[model samples]
Target chain A: MERRSKITPILLLAPAILIFVFIFVAPFIYLIFQSFWHYETSYVSKQVFTLENYIKLFSDPYYWRIYWRTFRLSVISTLITMILAYPISRMISRMPPGKKGLVTTLIALPMIGGGMIQAMGWMTMMMPYGAINGILLSLGIIKEKMTFLGTETGILIGLVQSFIPLMSLPLIASLGAIDPTLEDASKSLGASPLRTFFEIILPLSIPGAVSGMVLTFMANLTMYVTPSILGQGKIQVFGSFVYQQAISVGNWPFSSAFSLFFLLIMGVTAFLSSWITKSIQKSIYKGNEA
Target chain B: MKKFSMFLLLFVLLCVASTVIASPAEAADCNWDEATCEILDGADFGGRTMVVGVWGGTIEEIYRKYIIPEIEAHNGKVEMLLGGTSDRVAKVYAERENPTMDIAYTNMFESAKGIKEGVFEVPSADAVPAYADLYDVAKIDAYGMSFAALGIAYKPEAFEGEPDWPDLWKPEYKGKIAMSTFPGSDSEGFLTIAGYLAGGDDTTPDLAFPKLAELKPIPLFFANLDELFMMMDKGDVVAAAVFDSYTRTYIEQGANVKFSYPKTPGAIVTMDTLCIVNNAPNRDMAIAWAQMSLSPIVQEAFAREIYFGPTNSKLVLDEEAASKVIYGEEQANSLIRMSTYMTDHRDEIVERFNREIAED
Candidate 1:
């Protein structure tokens, strides 16, 4: 009976498992194989195995510079998103259920739109004489025109705008789970409002904040449209490099290698983030126990 | 006296009637009816769909106005697949065996590469009657559909006079000059011109980047025409490297930009090409499409509407249209064309361009 039950569950998930293998696993395996193969031309790639793609990539400092840029930008976006999303998440979490649902929907509205359109919107707004500058200039905020297109600040603005909701969702979950009376109890012990937050709310919300940060960080790291449009090709990031190699230069082997390497980096980042979140939560509980 | 006046009036009426009674095809010198267009007339397509891939905007508009109607008149449906050159080229190559795209519009760069790889059909007059009438430059790996020269698109207010190649290097214009992104016809042509400025040719690409680096702190690396034009309007970009056809089109549309031919070497030749994918779905329809594309009437529309130089040697534009487009064999031949040398060293050149020009 026990064996039959286990078999039935596997049978129920068989189609989904097959689909995952075909769409994700099978192509991924082929991509790995192709990464090692020698590139003859844009269309024709040789089957023989070679580590030339990896070796060539590692040899160039340009590729590493691009990787560092992507990493650096993503880290900055994540930190900013965390700071901005916390209060909004806390406010939303403490709201009445009816208003909460409505506000949350409105907050997540940008997520429903495609990245291309969003980036294009930002591109228009950040032009040398675009709306942002136009407004500022008319208001006598600046004497000279400020350039936003082809700058890191422009790309950062776009990343943070898109990611705040992602950060807020996770934060709302963890912050909501904290008991209201815990804050009151802390306050009853002669704790200041800020002290109550640090001793009670902030520590409890770390798990959610960490989850949000990781999500935002991963998103910003892999972002293509925002940087490609805002950076205007001046700022070289991993996404731009991959696109230029695969599409423009048509060096698929090298591009495949570049992508796989970044995939490894992404995996390590997620793992570290997860480990840090767990460790912080454990230490907080240990302090409580003591 | 009354009878004489009546006879004169009758004679004048007869002359007017004869002029009005003449065949519509006979009325125009450049007719596309049976007399001049026997190749496309009364063609039976059996209601099948012919898929054509071309860049959207004015180019696709020209095809729709001139070509699509001719096909539809003979029971053929043309589905327009509009996108960038790379995406279309990728499709034609990936589906070479059984291509859904009957006619794919490509640039000179990828068309040559596709033809070399046997992914595209070779150009021949046997399939398209008008092919025989194309200029020498148009007789290549595929049909050279249109030609334009790479030149400077400048704002008049920012320059002292009509600007040339050397004028771009003036100290005042340092950070305001915009360049097209690398690995494209515009950028490659610019590189070749830089090489020329450096006392070498396309054969010596190493000399090009160093000379180009002098124009650093470039404000914009424009791939989109609207973006470049907007910057020019805003007075942020004074001059930009662009093709004549686009500049002319924008000028007509009231954009604050002017097209100038450089004096040092000359404007670089950029050609838009058309190719039939190997084993394309609609072979007969594809042939018909090519014939219509190269016809004099269609070529005239392209010159008038979109400022592309007609590839057909038979196309003689009127004085006004001729002034707007590249007309006459001498002018066509005069446009400087860089060799396959630039395309051959694409990856290296793009890398160098990225390191030097694209980066701050």
Candidate 2:
């Protein structure tokens, strides 16, 4: 009977495995293969196997810096999203079920809306003589026009706005599942509001926070359109750099090498996040046993 | 119970397989091509469908009104794959081995780039009869079709003075200027403008960057002509480097924009060209469509209605439209032709421009 059940589960997973092979696994293998090869000048020339592309990528500062920049941007953006997400998620968790949908819709609107439209709207609002500057100028907050698009500040703002929802959704679900009695008990035990939040709510929500961070980091790392549109191609992210090498320079081997490097960085980040979350969970379980 | 679970698992797999098998057939329903044209006395197109890649908007409108209808009259079908110049070229390159689009219209530089990359197939004179009628400038198959220059398009109310390419870089006009967003193709015009502004030695990035860097205060860079015009409509920007046809169309749409040829020596010229994929699935239909599109009648119709000059010399324009375009023998001689030497240096120029000039 147990054997039959095991066979059924394997059968159930067959379609998923098939999909993974056809879409993700095959492409991943192809990308890894292409990374160690050299492309001739011709559009469809046979690829020559070599590790020169990776060697050059690693040796060059321009390509090397992008990996660090991508990592930094992803970490920074993820941190910002988490900081913003916690408060919003907390407020949503406290809300009555009836009003939750309205608030949820408002928060979810940006997520579901066209990214291109949001990007354009953000550019118009953030650019020099745009809404932000226009208001600041009128109010005498600044003497000179500020350039937003193509600046670091602009890219950060674009990344944050694009990713806030990703961080918040998981956080809301996790926060909502917390027992109300835990907070009330902490309050009764003479812990201050801030202390209660730190000792109770924050600790319980670690899993959700970790997941949100991983998601936001991945999204920001792979982000292409927002940064490209707002940064005016001046800001170089790994994704955009890979894209430029592939599309503009027509260097497929170099591009493939960059892509593999990007995937590796993203994989490391994801692994670290899960490891941290798991350790935290283990500690919490040990405390419960005590 | 295990038997039931096994059955359920099998059912799920069958469901997924069914969904996958059904999607493609459903997609083909809306975009059907008639095997035979009713307009051409029921002569069949031998089950051939010509996939055309071209620019959208006004060009798209003209194709529907004149070009496609004309082709359909001869029992041929044309499916217009609309996108920007670089995107169209990229698509052709991506599908090099198994080309989907039979005919594509792109800018001259991109066509040249594609030709060098072996993405486009060279056409014979027999395939394009209108080649003889094209002016000497357009006759060169650098990539695809003839070239057009980027001249000054301005609002007289906003500027109140005649402006040349150098005027675009004036510190006074900083934060008041707008340019197109895609720099890869438009960088040539910018370089030519930079060359003239820095005194005709644009080959050096040293001279070009300082002169072009003054325009760093430009408030906006638009992705398309429509966005640039929309900004102009709101009196945000005074002038820009744009083509003849776009300027004319904007004027027709009641945007108070003036089109002028800057008398600056070596003012920037751009080209628009058409190309066929090397191994097109429907070569006969593609060639026929190309001949039809570049034909005198079609080119004349494009000029009169859509505002771009036809490459064919046989298509004589109405006086007003003819006066607007930078054509004829004297006009052709005055303009500088872009050489292969300039194209090879395109990457370095773009990188430098982005690093030095574009940085805030």
Most accurate candidate by TM-score = 1
TM-score of the A-chain for all models: 0.96, 0.92
lDDT of 1 by residue, B63-158 (tens): 888778878878989999988776787677657777899989888878888888888888887877777888888887769888898999999998
TM-score of chain B of 2: 0.80
Predicted candidate 1 versus true structure: per-residue lDDT over A1-290, tens digit per residue? 99999899999999999999999999899889989999777655688999999998899999999899999999999998899999999999999889988998888988889778888999999998889999999999999878788899999998899898899988988998999999889989999999888778999899889889988999899998889899998998888888887777777788899999999999998999899889988988888789
Clashes of 2: 9
Q: Runs in model 2 with CA error above 4 Å?
A: A1-15, A39-46, A50-52, A280-290, B1-43, B46-49, B69-79, B142-147, B154-161, B166-179, B195-221, B225-240, B251-258, B342-349
For every candidate, what is the interface RMSD in angstroms?
1.8, 3.7
Write candidate 2's Cα lDDT for A60-158 as tens digits. Answer: 776666788777877888888889989998999889987876787788789788567788889889855579988999999999878787776788888
* Candidate 2 docking band: incorrect
TM-score of model 2's chain A: 0.92
